[model samples]
Target: MGELIVIRHAQASFGSDDYDRLSDLGHQQAELVGAALRDMGWVPDRLITGTLARQKQTLRGMGFDKAPEEHAGWNEYDFHDLLRVKFGGTIPDPVQHDRKTHFRTLRDVLREWQGGGVEGARETWTQFSARIASARQAATREGAERVLVISSGGAIGQLTASALGAAPEQMIALNLQVKNTAISRFIFTPRAFFLHEFNATPHFAPKERAHLLSYS
Candidate 1:
């Protein structure tokens, strides 16, 4: 079976303007993940990432000079658009408040979107899920044994939920828990892909890099 390694993009400029750019720490996290992957004796046969700057930057930061094939299907849903549509152009700022409240608000928005409540969403939840499935098919394409996909948390979470045949709400848990540069593994056969692991960050050992672990 071909193995697919899904890496969530490294930490972006969290709480900063232009959240699509990778922070200095994000670069460091990527390097660590790259080194850890090499240490595990795994080199990707193929590299894939979304068109997003953050996703591409994370791939570059991973110390691979090779160019990756861009897959827009792996691109994340636009949170700003979702919120604006859901709330009639009023986008809420969660950073000004507490963590619990921030997460609660995001979960609510996802729930609304999943239930088709987001009034003007360009891509429905079904569309997003279908996109993820397309990406998976491409990942397991012939001649690609060890495939690496660098994408955002939401897209990865959607992929995970779809793989497990879980309920829509379960995706919120995957989204909330995925860490920056985290590696989710799957064994891909011609028929289906089995989840080997989800949200594993072997690179960031608690004793050495506890502070570097970031969810955003």
Candidate 2:
């Protein structure tokens, strides 16, 4: 069976003015993940990444020299926008900068968004799920024996949950747990797609490197 290796992009500049770029630690995490994958001989026959800068940067840090095919479907939902929309055009200060409060609010907002409670959301829950499905179809195409994809935590969580026929709430749980630079794998054929692994972070298994593991 063909294999698809999906990697969530490394630590982004959370709470910074720009959250789309990877942080210094994120770069290190990406490089370590790349080295670990290489040691396992899990090189990809094809590479794909979202249009986001963070996704592209993660792929580059992975040390793969090939040009990756860009897919917007792999991009993350606009959480900042969602927060603003949910709050009637202005994000609360706590949600804007405090990690705990931000995620707490996010969880509630996601539930609302899923149930069509968050008005003016740029993309509805249905649309977001549909795009992920479309991206999976593209990634699982017959030509490549092994495909590597660089995406965000939200997209990865949604995809995995969808693959398992799990509830949307499970996606939020999975999304929160996915560490930066974590890897998830899938085995696929034209008509079959199975989750082989989820959120494996062998690179950070060493005690010294354990401190490097991060989510958000």
Residue ranges of candidate 1 with Cα displaced over 4 Å = 95-100
Residues 1-216 of candidate 1: C-alpha lDDT, one tens digit per residue: 899999999988765658798999899999999999999999998999999999999888888766789999999888767867766776556622345766677788899889988877899988988899888898789998999999989998988988899999999899999999999999988887889999999888867798899988
Pick the lDDT winner.
Answer: 2
Candidate 1 overall Cα lDDT vs. reference? Answer: 0.87
The residue pairs found clashing in candidate 1 are none
What lDDT would each prediction earn against the true structure? 0.87, 0.93
Q: Tens digits of per-residue lDDT for model 2 on 1-216?
A: 899999999999999999999999999999999999999998899999999999999999999998899999999989998999988898989899999999999999998888877878899988998999999999888899999999998899999999899999898899888889999999998888989999999999999999999998
What value of lDDT does candidate 2 attain over all alpha carbons? Answer: 0.93
- How do all models score by TM-score? 0.95, 0.99
List, in order, the clash count of every candidate structure: 0, 0
Question: In model 2, which regions exceed 4 Å deviation?
Answer: none
